[model samples]
Target: MTPDDERFDAKTTVLIETVGHHVQEEETDWFPKVRDALGRKELQEIGARMRDVRATAPHRPEHPGSLRAADALLG
Candidate 1:
C-alpha cells in the first residue's frame, strides 16, 4: 500500500482507541451519576432514545483528525 494509505489506517486505529477510552470513562464516571440522578423509568426512556439514535445513524469512515493522530502516533 501507499504511504498515504498506511497513514490513514494508522489514524483510524488511534481514533478507535480514543473512542474506547472515552466509552470506559463514560461508564465509570458519567453513568453512575446519571443513574443516581435519573429515575428508572426516565433512564429506560433515555435508553430507548439512545437505541433509536444508534439505529438511525448513518455509517461513515473515521474522521480525518483521528487519521492524522494515528499517523503521527505510528510514525
Candidate 2:
C-alpha cells in the first residue's frame, strides 16, 4: 500500500476507537449517573428545553451536491 493509504487507515482506526471508547463510557458511567440524579419531572423539563432550542436554532443551507454524496455513502 502507498504511504497515503496507510496513513488514512491508521487515522480511521484511531477515530473509530476513540468514538467507541466515548460511547462505552457514556452508556456505562455517564448515563447511569444522569438517570439517577434527575427525577422524571426534571428529565421532562430538560427534554422540553432541548426541543425548544432545536426548534429555534438557525438553519444553514447545505451544498447542492452534499445530499447526493451523503446518499452514495449511506445507501
lDDT (C-alpha) at residue 65 in model 1 = 60
Among all windows of 10 consecutive residues in model 1, the one with the lowest summed lDDT is: 66-75
Candidate number achieving the greatest lDDT relative to the actual structure: 2
Given candidate 1, what's the lDDT at residue 67?
55
lDDT of 2 by residue, 26-74 (tens): 9999989999999989889877765765554445437576565445434
| TM-score of model 1 vs. true structure | 0.57
RMSD of 2: 10.2
Query: Estimated TM-score per prediction?
Result: 0.57, 0.59
Instruction: List the RMSD of every prediction in angstroms.
Output: 10.6, 10.2
Per-residue accuracy of model 1 over 1-75 as CA lDDT, tens digit each: 454885888888888999999999999999999999999999888677667655544455365565554454344
| Candidate 1 positional error at 43, Å | 0.6
Query: Highest TM-score, which number?
Result: 2
Backbone clash total, candidate 1? 2
